[model samples]
Target: MTSITIDLSDSQFRKLQDFARVHGIAIEVLLKASLEDWLNLQKGDFVNTADYVLMKNAELYRRLA
Candidate 1:
């Protein structure tokens, strides 16, 4: 219902175009499917980036703990 603008790099644009052509779908339909999948990602199923970084560097945090 709403229009949005996005700019993709040449590589990204080419990849999307190729993928849509391979699947025999319109670019708009492919984009809508991608957006819906992203919107439906389970928030609780993935760790936040910062939390993941801290977890990876847990040795440095040992002193604080």
Candidate 2:
């Protein structure tokens, strides 16, 4: 694995440390999990196309044409 360096505000660093302590994990593990979640979100893995179809009103569909 490659090492990376990042800068964070004092508040942000404290928050991350606190989260890692509460979860009984190292800060790097928490950071990795957060980065993974963010990357998945960026790739649109959370969107549900079927749910959108179900949520659309029939009247709206009629109006489109």
Candidate 3:
């Protein structure tokens, strides 16, 4: 496995730490799962389709809002 380093603000790090502690997981595990989920979302056509639909219907959505 490859290791990486990220720079987070103190507040951001504290939030992550608190969330991990509350969930009973290590910070590393929480970060890994978050990264994996984000990566998976980027890998599919669903995002592209959603973007296309949203843009195509932007005027209708605005009127409905």
Candidate 4:
């Protein structure tokens, strides 16, 4: 797998760290899970940012519908 670096504000980093500890997972693993969840939500089959964009870009998700 490839590795990359991102910069987060102190508050954001702390929130992620706290969630990681609460779920008993490493920060990296939690981040990956979060990404998957976000992608799933954005597929429009679920509620998310995609809900709004889906209506405007109906053709983009023709197969999905």
Winner by TM-score? 3
Q: What is the C-alpha RMSD of each candidate to the true structure, in Å?
A: 5.9, 4.6, 8.1, 7.1
| Residue 45 shift from truth in candidate 2, angstroms | 5.6
Q: In model 3, which regions exceed 4 Å deviation?
A: 46-65
How good is model 3 by TM-score?
0.67
lDDT per residue for candidate 2 within 1-65, as digits (tens), equals 88899999999999999999999999999999989989988666436655577567667878886
Model 1 lDDT, residue 23, Cα: 100
Model 4 residue runs over 4 Å out of place are 45-65
Better of 1 and 2 by TM-score: 1
What lDDT score is found at residue 19 in candidate 2? 92
lDDT of 1 by residue, 11-61 (tens): 998999999999999988999998888876745346566678889999988
When 1 and 3 are scored with lDDT, the better candidate is 3
Model 1: number of backbone collisions: 0
TM-score per candidate: 0.62, 0.61, 0.67, 0.59
lDDT of 3: 0.94
Name the 10 consecutive residues with the lowest summed lDDT in model 1: 41-50
Q: Per-residue alpha-carbon lDDT of model 3 for 1-65, expressed as tens digits? A: 78888899999999999999999999999999999998888876688988999999999999999
**Winning model by lDDT:** 3
Between prediction 2 and prediction 3, the one with superior TM-score is: 3
